[model samples]
Target: MLVNRDNPARSNMLAHMGSLQQAAYTRPIEYQEGRSHGLRGIEVKNGPLRFMSMADRALDIAQIEYRGENLTFLSKPGLNGRNQFDTNGAEAQRSIMGGLFFTCGFENICAPYVTPEGSKYPAGSYPMHGRIRTTPAEHVGSDAYWNEDGQYVLEVSGEMREAELFGENMVLRRRISSVYGTSTITVEDEVTNESFREEPLMWMYHCNFGWPLLDEGAEVVIPSRKATPRDETTAADATPWNEIGAPVDNKPESVYLHDLAADANGRSFAAVVNRRLGLGVVIEFDAADFPYFMEWKSMGSGDYVVGLEPSNSSVHGRGWHERRGDLHTIAPQATERKVVTFAVIEGDAAIDALVARRDALLAA
Candidate 1:
């Protein structure tokens, strides 16, 4: 379970607590203020770790914290209600709220670009990262209980669909699950092509870390064989690609495409740790499913954060992806599944252990 603390069992913990909320639980909520009004959400807490997912935004993780420390970066853009979430004038890049675990792509990803005329996709601007985040979820549900394994389990599941007449139709079913007293939460997603025609798919999980969890000395531990800087300037800069830089004024973000290494089971772990803080965040997933990984280091004064993105394809425009002959597609009615686990590893020992895994991966 990779939980924070281990008790005799769930029964032992349950006996002391008057209610599940005292230790672990899941609750449905609604944002009632400003642009967030009317947006539905579900939050889950297990021990020192707690996170909330937006039911109105493809159920993406909107917040995460540990021991009252903000583990995710939140922008000035208050949570925009359903209708207010438009990418006009680069709103997402300028002011996105739950950037904590922002999801990109149902049809498009990366920078806003226009598909060529007479292309398979309608020739027009794809807008920033598609419409999945603004789409509301349906059939939302939450479950909290002690399982037969004697472990308290928390789950929130929902379905989100993005469709347009004479265009692509994709349905995403997501479930966020965690165990009581554990520091980890797993996100399971299944995306299906509901349209009759084959559709190009570009998916990426944008997991961001904020100031407390991310600092000047914090280092990212990933199993990358090498790195490819996204642009000439980044490539020209001799600063090591994997190193984290201190936040500075007008420090333009640097993006890198990493070539990852995985285990026999295709599982890989990427972590950001600040030994000084004795805190770290570990992300585990199947690299075989997500072949491409991008590191977004934005140490700007206001939006200081590091984004660990696991993607199915390159963030280069859809037309570029197609031209490269690497654009993945789902056959009509085909479904694909992706699972990622985010865990909190605190203390020197835990952080060291997690770093050792990356060391071993690099060696392998």
Candidate 2:
């Protein structure tokens, strides 16, 4: 067993080499067929990552630390330490802070969807949606979330199987039905533990898309006449919280409520244009589902991409509702569902097609 294939001292080297070659390309053993052995029991600590791709399926990216469990590449790093942006440096930092960059379809991190009241939630208490964690029983580190079901699913496309993130698992199961007009996938994930004592938690999608795939020439086209001013209570450009507030530099997680007083209706659409590449993508959400849309820009040196985020809550937290006298609460065992969709376009023609659709909807 310890012999090398080309060991000069071994008389059987030639024979062993031939055997190794045969083993390399021979059909896989029967046991390896169609088994969901999928990706179980593999430990990753750092560096090298395993990417699993199946025909006509979503790419399953597994980045494991050499000696540890898998890590979720969602969630943005805080603007503290290395993650913080230097005010005078490259504006891209504004976009990159908080580990939010990736080439995935888009990252969806939810829970306590937006900010809590200043006095109640505080910076220390802001509930971030995604985290690399481990359960006491398995001690295997993975992302955890409340009311999560129908989140990951193994699907068959052509000759491949993909892991997809479909919405709610029960009666309301939803998914990214189609992408780029060519592929369809469904993801399912369900977890139940007694310790998850529930409360009204925050939830929001943390999607990152970029590159020659999404580039600097890319821009966001939201169907809003005005953006709610960034809440000054916590942001650098904190200002009064109102519908008709000034045009402030937008930041991620900043609260943006519908400004009905503006010409456009609360129900607006947003699109991202990668003009140089002649590609565009549009995201549409109803104010009824996500009442706010945030345009997060990283003004410091970093990658240039736009965040067209739609949220159910304001960045000021439920407390803002209290201040405005609009706070609402959900009791135990209560579940709320939100849905958003993205469609890809090919070039200026595609952008015009989307714009035409938007105009038609508005006209109707």
Candidate 3:
């Protein structure tokens, strides 16, 4: 059976099925207002896992909690309760940093970049991480129903467009889903260029971790042969790239570029584990679309968090991409799809299993 968020008959049918198959009704999704940080969002609960995606913001995953404990990091001050376009440039970017996850890039550029010599941007223009995060999602919708195996599933989907009068026209259609009885959330996104001209496309999934899960002794595990620091500052502490430090008063942030080892299916995984807490979070994604994995470590007091970012381009601006000849372009009317899955691994056994998977992928 299927249920459409706007269809009353389908909704009633879903309710009837829920009564008939109570065991399959473990997934519950709710449309909430003034949720985390006073922002509107959709809350989905599946077993011991729950997540909230902000509807008023960039549709970023605002919170992810397991067993009543938040697994994701939130900014200290919290959501600003404002629209993306309400502010301009850097101010807009800083305002949306409160969420656990936010997308970057589509046009203009991701990362801080100076206008290239032949670029359309004016001279001395510095755009920090594309405007996509600040662009609110449109056509938001949610639905829940039983799958063929009688297991319930919930999904929230939306579309966001980044366009200007004579600028790039790109549309992103995103869907986040979860199945009952599981601690996993899957995100599938399709970015399309709806304009007549080809456009540069740079995107990154900024997934941040914090608090109990990111405390002392926590570590990041990835199947990579080599790691490169973003600059000399990071290179100085390169040996501890996989380790988390105790929060300090004014510790500087470090960034690294990981060349992951993927399996035969082009799939790779990374995880942040805290053995003392007996909990961890794993991110599995396709290496074809996002070949670069970046680790952002910020252990300063009141701003302690680690970001596991996967992207197609470097965190350096578009100019760097152009210089490196790694800039990706999407043709007019063409669409590109990317999929990522986030799952929680609990207990020593689960953590070991994740480690084994990474090892196996490396061995292959």
TM-score of each: 0.93, 0.46, 0.87
Ranking by TM-score: 1, 3, 2
The better-scoring model by lDDT among 2 and 3 is 3
Candidate 2, residues 253-292, lDDT tens digits: the string is 3434334221245455566565566655455555665555
Clashing pairs in 3: none
Error of 3 at 240 (Å): 1.0
Write model 1 residue lDDT over 1-364, tens digit each, in one string: 3543554775576688888698788999998898788888888888888888888888888888888888787876767666633655255554466446877887788777677766666655666776677778899999997665667789999899888888889999998899876788898999999999988788988888887878888888888898899997678756575566777888778888999989878899777888888888888999988888998877778878888989898856577787777778899999999999998888999977877777888888
Could you say which candidate leads in lDDT?
Answer: 1
Best by TM-score: 1
Ranking by lDDT: 1, 3, 2
Model 3 C-alpha lDDT per residue in residues 15-81, reported as the tens digit of each score: 7664523422223234434423445577776657877787665677878888887777887646545
Clashing pairs in 1: 3-182
Off by over 4 Å in 2: 1-124, 127-198, 213-216, 231-268, 322-328, 360-364
Q: Which 10-residue window in model 3 sums to the lowest lDDT?
A: 20-29
